[model samples]
Target chain A: MEASTSRLERDYRRVLRLLPAGYRRQWGDDMVGALLDAEQSAAAASAADEGPERQAEERDIALLQRPPLREVAGVAALAVRLHLASPSTAGATAAARLRGDAVRRVALVGLLAAAGPALLSAVTGLYWPVPPELEALGHTRVDALASALLALVAVAAFALFVTGRHRTASVLAVFAVVPDLRHPLETLASAWRVSPGTLLGAACWLLVLLAPLVALLAWRSDAPRPSRRWLLALPVVAALGWVPWLLWRATGALVAPDAAGSLALGAAACAVVALRRSDASWMRTAAVLAAVGGLGSLGQLSLLGYPPGLERDLGWTALGTVLLAAAVGVVAGVTGRRWSAQAAPTAVTAPDRSASDASA
Target chain B: MALTEPAVLVLTALVGETRHGYALIAGVEELSEGRTRLSVGTLYGLLDRLSSEGLIALDREERHQGRTRRYYRLTDDGAAALEAEAQRLAHLARAASARLRTARAV
Candidate 1:
C-alpha cells in the first residue's frame, strides 16, 4: 500500500511539470497534496460501498492507479492558457496583446479578401450578361445557382466572424471551402503520376483557402470583437474588379481581375496596415499576411513556363510584390522583437493593469 | 466581471469560512450536486485569477497527514461579486419559472 501510494504520487508530480516553471514553483506541492487527498477520499467512498472482502482489494488497486486522463487534459489546458496569457511583466503583456491583435486582423483581412472574389463571382454568375451560346447550356443554370449559394455561404461566414459569432463562423468558413477542396483533393489523389508543377499549384491553392481558417483559431473567447468597418472592404474590392472586367468586356483594352490579382490586392492591404502601424505586433501581423500572400503568388507559378503571355506576366508581377512585402515584414518583425526586449526591464518595474483585467 | 460557474462555486464554498484545496473541491462537488467536478489544475487556475482580482486571499497553511494544505478565504470583494452574481441568476431563474408556469396554465 505504501509503495503504491508513492508510485501514484510520483506519476502525478510528473504530469504537474507540464505547467510553467514559475507556476509549478508556487503551486506544485499544494496541487499534489490536493490530488492525493481527492484520490484517498474517492477510494474511501468506493470502499464504503463495497463488501468487506472486496474493500481492501479495491483500495490497493486504487492506490496504484495513475492520474486520470481528464486530470491530465485539464492540466494541459491550464498550461496552454498560462503560456499564451503570459502574465509576466508589463512589456510581455503588451507584446502578447499586440500578437493577439495582429492575428485577429490577419483573420479579418484574409476572410475579407476571400469574400470579395466570391461575391463578385456570385454576382457575375447571377446577374451579369451571358452570351447566347453559353446560356443555351442546360447545366449552366444549376452551376450558377450552386456557385451563388457557395458565395453566399462564404460571405455569411465572414459576417458572422466579424460580428463575434466565431464558432458558427468557423464552421461555415470550413463548409465554404468544401468546393475549393475538390480540385486539390483530386490532384493529391493522383500523386503518383502528377507533374511537379500541377502538384505544387494544387498544394499552394489549398494553403490559400486554408490560411484564413487557421488564423481564425486566434479568435478565442477572450479576444476582442472585431469592428464592423471591415465589412465595407468587401464591397469596395468587389467593385474595383467590376471596373476592369467591364472595361475588358466593352473595349477589350483592359485586363480582367483574376484570383492572383485579388491575392495581390489582399497582400497590398496587409502591407498598408503593417506600414501604418509602427508597433512590433503589427509588424508580426504583416509577416503572417505576407506568408499567406506569398503562398498564393507561388501558386501562380504553374501559370508560367507553359506560355509567354498575360498569365505569365501577371504571375511574375504577383511573385515580385509578395517577395518585396515579405522582406519588409520580416525585417520589421525582427526589429520590433528587439525593441520589445529592450523595453521589458522598464516595464517590469511598472504595474500591470492590463494583466489584472486580462480575461480568465 | 461576470463569475464563471466554477468561480461562483469556489466563492460559495469559501463563504463564511476558510477552506483548503481538497475541502473546496469537495464543497464544490456537494454544492453542485455532483454535476461539476473541478480538477486540481482548474481549481488552482481559478484561485490564482481570483486572488489576483482581490476576490479571494490566502488565509493560512497547515501540515495535515505530512502534506502542506493552504487555506483560502473570500474577501469582501469576493462576497460582493458572489452576491451580485447570485442576484443575477436568481432574477433569470424567477423569470424562467414565471414563464413556465404561465405556459402550463395556458
Candidate 2:
C-alpha cells in the first residue's frame, strides 16, 4: 500500500510541474494533499459498493490511476490566466491593464484598417461612373448593389465596435469576412491543378479575414471602449490608404496594392506612437499589424511565376517590405514591453503566516 | 461582479464555516445537489481568485494523516456579496413565476 501510494505521489508531482515555479513553490504541497485525499475518498466510496474481490481489484486500479484530464485542463486554464495577467488575477493590475490596452488597440486598429478600403469601395461603386466597356463585360446594377452592401457591413462593424456595441459588431465583422473567403476558397478548391504559390495565397487570404476576429478576444467585460473620436479617423484612413495606391496602380502596376497599403498603415501607426509619448500599447499594435502584414505578403509569392512583368515585380517588392516591417516591429515591441515592465511599480503583499505555518 | 455558477457554489459552501480543500469540494457538490463536481485545480483556482478579491481568506491549517490541509473561510465581503446575489436570484424567480401565472391564466 505504501509503495503504491508513493508511486502515485510521484506521478502527481510530475503533473504539478506544469505550473509556474513560483506557483508551485507557494501551493504545490497543498494541491498534492488535496488531490490524494479526493482520490482516496472516491476509491473508498467505490469499494463500499463492491464485493471483497472486486474491492481488492478496484483498489489496485485506483492506486495506479493518474490525475484526470479535466484536472489537467483546469491547470492549463489557470496558467493562461496567470500568463495573460487576466483581470481576475490579483495584484497584477498594472501588467493586466497594459496587456488589455495593447490587445484592445490591436482589435480597434485592425477593424479601422479593414473599414477604410471597404468604405471607399462602397462609395466609389455607388458614385463613380462605370465605363461602357467595363459594363459590357457583364457588370450589372445588382452586382454593384451587392458589393456596396458587403462593404457597408464592414464599415458598420468598425463603427459599432468603436462605439462599444461589440457583440453586434462581432456578428457584422464575421459577415464581412464572407466575401473575402470566395477567392481563397476558389484557390484552395483548385489545389490539384494549381501551384503551391496559389495555396499560399489562399492561406494568407484566410489569415487576413480572421485576424480581426481573433483579436476580438480583447473585449473582456472590463476592457475600455474606444472613444467616439476614433470615428473621425475613418475619412483620413480612407483617403490615405486608397489614394496613393490607386494612383500608383493606375500609372504603373507597383507592388501588391493591399500589401503596400498594410505596410504603410503599420508605419503610420508606429509613427503616431513615435511622435507622441511612446508606450507598450502602440508598440504592441505595430507588432500585431506588422506580423499580419508579413504573413499576408506570402500571398504575393503566387505571382512570382507570372511572365516577368508587373506581377513578378509586385511579388518581390511586397515580400521585402513586409519582411523588413516584421523584423523591426518585433524588436521594438519586445524592447518597449521590457522597458514598461521595468518602469511599472509592482505591488508586493506579505505572505499569510498562518498558511505558511500550516504547510510547514 | 457576477459570480460564475461554480464560484457561487463555492461561496455558498464556505458560508458560516471554515473548510479544507476536499471538504469544500464536498460541500460545494452537496450545495449544487451533485450537479457540480469541482476538480482540484478548478477549486484551487477559485480559492486563489476569491482570496485575492478579499471575498475569502485562509482561516487556518492542519496536518491530517501526514498531509497538510489548508482551510478557507468566507470574509464579511463574501457573505454580503452572496446575500446580494441570492436576493437578485429570488427577485428573478419571483418575476418569472408571476409572468408564468399570467400566461397560464390567459
True contacts kept of each: 0.38, 0.36
CAPRI quality level assigned to candidate 1 from its DockQ score: acceptable
TM-score of each: 0.76, 0.76
What overall lDDT goes with each candidate model? 0.72, 0.72
Candidates' RMSD to native: 5.4, 5.1
What's each prediction's clash count? 0, 0
Candidate 1 local lDDT, A1-360, one digit each (tens): 134346668888889788666567666778888887787677767878677667666655665889888778878866655544433311123444555567767777777777877788888878866656877875477777777878988888888988889899989888988888899889989998998877887887787777777777667666667788878887887777677668657865444434434544565566556556655555666666666667666766655564766776666656674675567556666665775575453322113222342322
For candidate 2, give fnat to 2 decimals. 0.36
Error of 1 at B3 (Å): 2.8
Error of 2 at A325 (Å): 1.1
